[model samples]
Target: MPNLLIIEDEAAIRRVLSKILKEEDESYQVDEAADGVEGVKKIKANDYDLVLCDIKMPKMDGVEVLQEIQKLKPEIPVIMISGHGDIETAVDTMKKGAFDYIAKPPDLNRLLNTVRIALDRKELITENKRLKRKVSKNYQMIGESEAMTKVKDMIEKVAPTEARVLITGENGTGKELVAHWLHQKSERAKKPIIEVNCAAIPSELIESELFGHVKGAFTSANKDRAGKFEAANGGTIFLDEIGDMSLSAQAKVLRALQENKIQRVGSDKDIKVDVRVLAATNKNLKQEIADKNFREDLYHRLAVILIEVPALNDRREDIPLLITHFAEKIAKEQGTQVCTFTNKAIKLLQNYNWTGNIRELRNVVERLLILGGKEIDDKTVTQFSGK
Candidate 1:
């Protein structure tokens, strides 16, 4: 149910607004405040989806109340009710933070529409906050080793710039995480960050995937579509496993980098794009260039700032921290308490070779959470960890 607050100095107007809101929807819980003081108190005490405040109250006017609400709870949408004489003041209040302004004799349709819009805006704000929390949790970088620390420092320094970043690391070393952090921390954070896995897509279709194709360009191309670069306009595009990209696609990508433009498959016209490019590959680009498997020009274009993620075996000291982090995260996902790992268990796990790196470690942690005892000892680690 949506909670609403009506802060009107006129008793008749207060009753009318409450009656109209309650009659409009049985789910709306409307509360009335005689003046601004009482309204501020109620607003501070409760969470309201919308607030209707009179612009010309005796104790404290709507503008003062809106200012207070801005300080107390800026998320709550406040609508200022104003008379003919207070119309200018009501508009000023909106500039000061009021969500909207309603006339002295509120129109039935206008009042209802305003209320609905305010409630919808409030819901959207709440949902966006929730999603931001989830995204932050998902992209959390967990490691305090020297190598990890250097990567973090580089991200801080380089993330603010428009320079292309090429992350180099072995498979499963969390290259994708670095790309996400860079986008999340950049000036283009508000825009989309489109990710394309070059290795996952077939060589034949890679060009069409990166640059959209017109209808009949390919058998699968039925209609015109926007490709990843167009979708990431005014944002960032992360090309993962760029070493595996075909030589033909590499030539097109190099052109896009040099000209800040791309031509769709089967189209001669070029579409200009403003996208910050970030690439990552597990393969050694120099070796790939030597073998003529990858383009040297493209590699140089993408590697303006190189970030090499350390293999898990090299950062064994961070295993304990990673274990605790993964344990808490897995517990939350599983709706269970976080299991503890004994010191001996930690030591044993750290000594083992992490062939698959952090990706493998997270899976092992989840497995232990399911199969190991409440306190995972060295014996439980040996039995379940496949060591």
Candidate 2:
């Protein structure tokens, strides 16, 4: 059943429209608003599927009401009613975001059909969002290496509880991938996963970015905004490249972990968050701690369950399997036939030092697929790999 609002100033027309809509479908719960001002007020106060608004009214015009509706409740579809003389104004309303136009003394069939189409479109939008969330929920850990297998086992054992996970690995070793798998497999997966790339955000803004700020708190802070911790209230937050976080930010992070609360920048009131933190780093944190680059207390707090990802070279035995997997995936992505790699070519690739790790391997595979002939062999590897 769809909830509908009728914002026609004419009492007789409102009654007639309401009777027609209800007669067409008894399940539709319709309400009447006397004018555009009242219509905008109702929209802000409640959620509705469709709104039927008149083109002219006292205090606020239909176009102004439509703009306000879009600003506050953009998802609700609005069908504007215009008299024959108001056709130009109704077209102008469409440019301002009105869904569709209905002539004054609406044609019963046309009005009902338009309402049905708008309702169906809204349903489809909601369904598509739901399917997208389901797809994101299915972000499984993908790898066949023994290292990855062990990591998956660890995630299974640790996900049921609220222990902090510290994922350590070299650059391009899929540390972020492990973090995602941990959150998706954990009990908190149903909750939101707010991500914070400590290195990507500027150090000066990191504090406000994580803890939020009150209106007029800073030079550019125009309004009160919720921080990362507040946004991830009931779920997990993956802090990528945490080792690069500023010393001051690290102090705040340690306090949040210790107290389960965070105080916004330039504010004293602490906000509690039920967020499970998953931190990842490519640097040796122990060394960073020694150099005064990282906090030792935060280190112990985050490293409760350290899951180190082995570099590609450390797991040479998995190279053939990873190569074949990447080859098939790349072929499908490129819409080309999968090329066959000789045993010797695979062996040569396995022996090479993959300084950039698995990411580099995938790039090489793509290069070979694009540049090498139908069969990728040792000669192609020797030429492309600069061996």
Candidate 3:
């Protein structure tokens, strides 16, 4: 249902407007105000979707009322009702943030159409804000351990600069979380952050995947396609699991880094791109270079700033916080009651060998929440957490 308010000093006009709107749509909950003072008071005490104010009024004129609404609750769309002589003033009100204006003898179709459009726009704005909050919550960091503090401090220092970062950590150690934080805090945060799992793509197509390909470049190349570099142009490209990238593809990435340009797989044409590079890996790049499996030049280019994410076992102090975070997340996802863990249960979990790191811990937390009691305790941990 949409809530609407009409602020008109004339009792007869207010009654007729309210009657027409209600008959047009019974879902409209319309409220009336004798003057701008009463209207502003109603506004401050309620959450209205739309407001219709008359240009000519006493005590508080429509212009002053509109200004107050702008300062108080600007999101509510205000449509000015204008008399024949108030046409110019109505247009002036729009310049001061009025959504639109209607003439004194309002056209039935125009009044309803404008109201519907304004309500739709307000709904879209509310939905967009909701989605943004959800996205931010998904990427939230939930740790205050000394090791995590150092990593966060490094991010705060390096995020504002145009430096390439190489993040190294064991498997399942939340390396991707660090990558997301870096991108979100950078100057290019508004642009997309493209992630490529080098190990997941076949070695035969790695170059084309990173640099794109022209039509007829390969047997499966039916059409031209843009790759990660082109897609992330003016943004950040996160090469996850960089250790598994082929030696040949590494050469092209090296060129892109050095010259800020890339060539399509089967085309000699070079495309310039302004991209910040961030790479992550579980393997030792130094050892890969020594074994001739990785290029030393690319290592130097990407490691201008190095961030090493600590394994869960190394930061045991943060495990309790992580469990609570994961528990609330899982509960919300499953649409169930949020679960809590006893101190003994949290301590038991913290003492385990988290060889698979944070990823494995999240899985265990979800499993326990499903099978254990609402209040998770040491017995539940021992029985359902599988140590």
Candidate 4:
């Protein structure tokens, strides 16, 4: 529900504003205050989505009320209610962070439009905050083991540069996490980071997917569309599993890296893209090159800075920390209490062969939280962990 506050000293004006607002939208939970003092009190007590304050009120005025709101709850947008001669004050209020002002006897269209736009902006701001929190959690680097520390140090050093990075690791070793950390810490952090899993996408359509295609370029190319390179312009593009990319697509990628330009499938015209490419692969590119399945020149272009993520087995000392992290993460996602494990249980889990790496550890931890006792024990790990 949209909770609104109407703070006017005059009883007649308050009633009019309330009537106009409630009739406009019944879902509006409108609250009333007799003066600016009462309005500030109400605002301090409850969370209001929007506040409508009169400029010339007894006790405190709207300007002072707005200043107080700016200090108290700046997120709650305030709209000044101006008298006929208070246009200058109304304009001035906007410069100080007021959302907008409505003249006395508010116009139905203007008042409603301003409120709607303000609410929409508030929703966007709220959503962006939530996304930022989520992103931080998702990209968090969680381990202090020597091997993990080295990787963290590399990210801190390499993320500031515009170098092409090749992240080599086995499946489930969290290669994409390194890619995300790089983008988050780089100068182009404000821009988008577009990711494409080369192995997941078929070889036949890889070219079209990377460089786009015009209408009638292929049976499914019904409309002109931009590709990943174009979308990642002035930002970063993460090519996951690049060793699986087709030989022909590798040629175009080589050209893009060499000339900073690419031609869409079935289009001879070259489109320039200022994109920093980050690639990852589980397979050995050298072996692939000898097999005549990968391009050596493209490998050289992408391997300017190579980051080899260690397997979970190599960093077994970090298992306890990872388990605790996963338990809390799972609790937050599932809206439950964080589950704890006994030291014996932790030892048992850490001894297991972690061929599937950190990704597999998280899954096992989630399973334990779901099925194990409140305080998980060694026996619980034995019974529930399918290891």
Candidate 5:
């Protein structure tokens, strides 16, 4: 049931209004306040989906109540009710942030219609907020190391602004996690976080992948397609392993970064884009630049805020915590009870070389869960971990 608050100074008017709303729909749980002062108190105490307040009241007026509610609970929709002379005041109340207005001597149909519309609008606003939170949850970072802490701190500071970010780390070290953090903390979290692995795509197709192509632009371009940049409009685009991108593709990427414009591989028309580019690479771009394989200008452009993720070997202290996290996660995925690793097993894990880093550790933990006994021990480590 949707909670409704009616703020009318006159007790008789409040009762009549409540009766009409309930008759129209019993699903509405109605509460009444005699004056704006009492209405404000009720609003402060409980959360209501909709409020119906009269324009003129004693001790406080509807407009004052609306302003206070706007400060305290802006998401709750308010519909102002006006008397014969207060219709003009109700119009002004909307300027102060009222959802809609209904005239006094309440017209049943008008009240019902306005209430339905206001409730529907509120539902949409709430649903949009819920979806956005789900998007943020998709990018949850799962580490407690100092390296991750510093990366998170930087993301908090940089995500609000449109800054180019370059994430550097070894393979499986979670450079992509840094990129996700940047986008999730950003003002553009509501937008898509489009990811393109430059190394995965063939050099011949990288241009079309980043800038998109029109119909018949190339041999395989049967239809007009939007690329990563267009898909990430008003949000962020993450280019992974960018150092391995071809020189030809690098020039086009640099053009997109510098000019905020890109042309399709076989088309001459340029399209404007408003995208925040975040690039990551396992290779050393500075060395690649020295060899002339990577564009020096593009490297400088992308590295405005550089974040380097440390390898698991360097942060061995976090391995025990990480192991437990992955164990619980794997247990849930496999529909089994959470398993525990012995202290000796964790110590052995810390001593091993994590050349493949955190990604490798997660895989190793999953293997232990499946192959090892209820309690993962040092002997189980040697038997299954391939250490």
Candidate 6:
């Protein structure tokens, strides 16, 4: 049941509001307060979906009550009830954070409609907060090692800025995970983060992939399409495996970074884009630049805030935690009971080389969970981990 509070000095008006709300929906549990002081006490004692407060109350005014609510429980939506003389005060209350204002002798239709809308808005806000929590958990960085702590510190410091980020790490070292964290934590968290793997797309088609092509730009261009850069406008674009991008595509990426503009493949018209570019590469970009395989200028542009993800082998202390995390995750995915790793098994597994990093660790954990007993032991680790 949705809880509602009516704070009004007028006993007659308070009764009317409560009656109307209960009549509209019997499920609504309405509470009444004779003055702002009583209202603030009730607000602090119980959670309310919506608050209907009178703007002109004696002892303590509605505006003052709203201010207190804003300090105490800002999430609760407050609707100010105003008389003909208090309309201006009601408007000012809204500026101070009241959800909406209801005029004197509240219109039946308007009052009910506003109440429903306020409740709906509150529901949407609650749902959004829940979803954000789920997303944060999904992208959580799971290590307490010194190397991992440094990465987390860097993310906190750099995520709020508009500077470009270049994540460097070997294959399967969770470079993409770092990119996701940066985008998720940044000011652009609400905006989309389009990811494009440079090595996955063919060299000939890489340009068209990054910067859209006209309808008749090429033989395969049957329709006009927007590219990754345009798609990521007002957001972020993660260029994974950037070292493998063709020189032609590299030049366009450089131009885009330089001018915040891009020309679609085979199109002379320049299209402007407002995007944060985040690139990742496993290969040594400096060496690539030395060999003339990568553009030094582009490297400079993308490396404004470089984050190097440490290899899993270097952070061996995190192996035990990683094993538990992966075991629980895989069990949930497979709808099976979570398997456990003994201390001996974990120590033995940590002693082995983690050439593939976290990705490799997760795979090995999954294999052991499937092939070993519920309590994975040292013998089971030796059999399934292939260490």
lDDT per residue as tens, model 6, 46-88: 9999999998888899989999999999999999999999998
**186-233, model 4: which lDDT tens digit per residue?**
997876677899998988999998998866799987545667887777
Off by over 4 Å in 2: 1-142
True-structure lDDT of candidate 1: 0.90
Candidate 1 residues lying further than 4 Å off, grouped into runs, are 1-134
lDDT of each: 0.90, 0.86, 0.91, 0.89, 0.87, 0.89
Candidate 4 global lDDT? 0.89
Query: Where does candidate 3 stray beyond 4 Å?
Result: 1-137
Candidate 6 lands at a TM-score of 0.66
Worst 10 residues of 4 by lDDT: 123-132
* Residue 282, model 1: Cα distance from true site in angstroms: 0.7
The TM-score that candidate 5 achieves is 0.65
Kindly indicate the candidate among 3 and 5 with the higher TM-score.
3
TM-score of each: 0.67, 0.66, 0.66, 0.67, 0.65, 0.66
In the range 274-379, model 2's lDDT, one tens digit per residue, is 9899999999999999999999999999999999988988888888987898888889878999999999999999999998998898899889988999898999
Per-residue alpha-carbon lDDT of candidate 5 for residues 158-231, written as tens digits (9 for 90 to 100): 88889999999999998887887788888887777778999999998888888887667878775456677876
Model 1 lDDT tens row, 1-387: 999999999999999999999998899999999999999999989988899999888998888899999999999999999999998888888788888999979998789878876875576556545645655779889999999999999999999999999999999899999998998999988776778999999999999889887667888775465677877778889999999999999999999999999998988989999999999999989999999998888889999999999999999999999999999999999999989999999999999999999989999999999998789999998999975
Each prediction's total of clashing residue pairs, residues at least 3 apart in sequence or on different chains, is 0, 0, 0, 0, 0, 0
